[model samples]
Target: MSGTVLVTSRSFGSGGLDLERRISDAGFHVVRAGAAHELDELGPVLGDAVGWIAGTGPVTERHLSLAPHLRVVARYGVGYDKVDVDAAARRGIVVTNTPGANTSAVAEHTVALLLAALRGIPAADRRVRRGDWSAWYTREVSALTVGVVGLGRIGRSVIDRLAGFGPRVLGADPWVPADDPLFDRLERSDADAFATECDVVTLHAPGGQTVVDERWLAASDRPVLLVNTARADLIDEAAVAAALRRGRVLAYAADTLATENHGEGASPLLADDLADRVIVTPHLAAQTREGVDGMGGMATENLLAVLSGEPPVNPVPVP
Candidate 1:
C-alpha cells in the first residue's frame, strides 16, 4: 500500500460491501478508528493517512493540521455539517459527502416515525407487552393536514410518500423557488403556518437552525404530532418536552437527540413523564442496508478520486 486511509465510520462496510478491500486494492492501507474522532486516539493514525472516511464526529481545523499526508475527507453520509470543509480547504484537503445516498432510507424512516407518533405505536407496543389489550385511539393520516419542512431531496421524497395517505400536504422551504412544480402537488406555507395549521409536522430541514422552539410551539392552536428524522438541533428538546407536558405536542418522535454520544440523561425529552408520548431512535433513519451500501460506495469513490489526483465526485464547497 502506498498510504493509509483512515476509516472512522462504524457503518462504513456494515452493508457487506467490502469497502476496505476496495481501498486496499487501490494501493492504500485501511486503518480503523473510533467514530468519536478523539485527538489523542487519531494523532498517531493522522500522521501517515492519505484519506479519511469520517463519521458524525466533528473534524476540526486541528484535525486537518495533524493529517499532513491527508488528501481527502470523505464524509460517510449525506450531511457534511460535522466536517470542517473550510478548514480542510485551507489545508489543501478535499472534503466530500455522500449526497442522496441515504435519501430514500431517511424519507421512508421519516414517514415511519410520523405514523409511529400519530398512532402511538411505541406506547401501544409497550402496553401490549404489559398484558394490556385495549385499543389505542388514534387519528387517521387521511384526516390530518400534514406539513413537511424543507423541500430538499429527502423532504420531497417524504412528500411523495405522504401523497398516498390522502392528507392535504403543506411544504415549507425558503430556499425552494415559488415557481417550482412541487407546489402543484402540495400547498406552500411558511414556518409560522406549519406550527398553527399543521396537524402533523415532519422536519427535514438542515442543521444549525432551530425550527421548533418555545415560540414556535406557543404559536400552535392545537396539539400536533411532530416527527424528526433530520438533525436533532432542528427542535429544542426543552421546548418539546414542555409542550408534551402541556399537551401542546401530542407526540414527539425523532431519530436523533442533542446528547447522543455523551448521554441520553442530559435530554429533557427522555423524562419519565414523557415516555408514553416520545419515541427516540438511535439516529438510524439512514442505516438501512441499501443506504449503508450507497453511502459507503460514494464515500469510497470520492476518496479514491482525490487520492489519485482527481476532483472528488461530491466535494463540499468551501465557504
Candidate 2:
C-alpha cells in the first residue's frame, strides 16, 4: 500500500480525473514520470516504482533492468510495439494492453476517411467557399471491393460498419480463428490476392510490420484507394507518395504517419502536388470520449490487478 505507482503516460489520466483520484484513494502515492521515453530520465523514478502504467515509449530491457521492483507494465493503449514483451517476460514482469477499447471509434473514423477520400468532401467544401463548383464525380463506396489487411478487433469492427454500405468486404488475416462468426459475412483472401483484387485497401494490422509497402502496392491492377487507421509502421510513406504521383495509387487516407512530431514541410506526402490525393488526420481516430474512457478504465483495472498480485484482465499473450 505504501509503494508508489508511476504513471509514465501523459494520457493515462487525460480521459478523466476520476481514474487518477481512484488511484490516489487506494492509499498509494501516484507520480508522473514525464512521458518516460528515455530510460535515463525515468531511471530515478523506475528505481522504486512497483507498478508502471506505460505510454508509447521504448520499454527496453535496459529500462526493465533498471526497474528492480517493477512487477507490472500496463500499456495505455492497444499496441505494445514499443514495449519489449520478451524482455519483460524473461524478468517476470506482467504486461497488459487494452484491446477492443478503441475499436468502435477507430472503425467509425475509418469509414469517415473512406467517405472523405471517395467523395472529395474537403476539396468540394473549399470549392464551394471559393464560389466555383463546376462538377465533381467521386467513386461510390457500395460498388468497391474493400480488402482489410487484419481481422483483429478493430479490423472486424471496420467490416461491421462497411456491411451497411453494401460493399464487398474481403478480410485477410491468418491470426483470425477459423470458427469466427465474421467468416459468415466476410470472404477470405490472401495478402497478394487482396492487394490485387480489391478496389480499396485498408490496413488494420499490428505495428512493427509493413503491410502496405511498394511491393504490396505494385501488385494492384489499378490505382487503389489505400486507408490506414491501424498504425504508421504499416505503410511506407515515401513509397505511397511515389505511387500517388505516378497514378499507381488513387488516394491515401490515414489517421497515422511515420512520426507524430513532424515540423513544417517534414513529410513527403505534404507536397502541394499530392495534396489532393492524400488526406491525413492527427491521430484523432481513437480519441473520442467513449474510447478514451474505455482505455483508461481498462488500463487502470490492469494496474490494480497486477498490484494486487492477480492476473490482468487483458494480458498480452506471449508467443
C-alpha lDDT values of all predictions: 0.91, 0.84
Q: What does the lDDT come to for candidate 1?
A: 0.91
For residues 1-319, what per-residue lDDT tens digits would candidate 1 score against the true structure? 3899999998899996988999999998999998888899999999999999999878999998999999999999888887888888888999999999999999999999889888888889999999998995799999999989999999999999988999999999999999999999889998788888999999988898999999999999999999999888999999999999999999999998998765337699988889989999988998999999999999999999998888888999888
Query: What CA root-mean-square deviation does each model show from the true structure?
Result: 1.3, 2.3
lDDT string, candidate 2, 123-148, tens digits: 77877899988777778889999999
Task: Tell me the TM-score of each prediction against the true structure.
Answer: 0.97, 0.91
Ten-residue stretch with the least lDDT total in model 2: 258-267
For candidate 2, the per-residue lDDT at 205 reads 87
Q: Cα deviation in Å at residue 310, candidate 1?
A: 1.0
Residue pairs whose backbone atoms clash in candidate 1: none
Off by over 4 Å in 1: 263-265
What is the TM-score (0 to 1) of candidate 2? 0.91
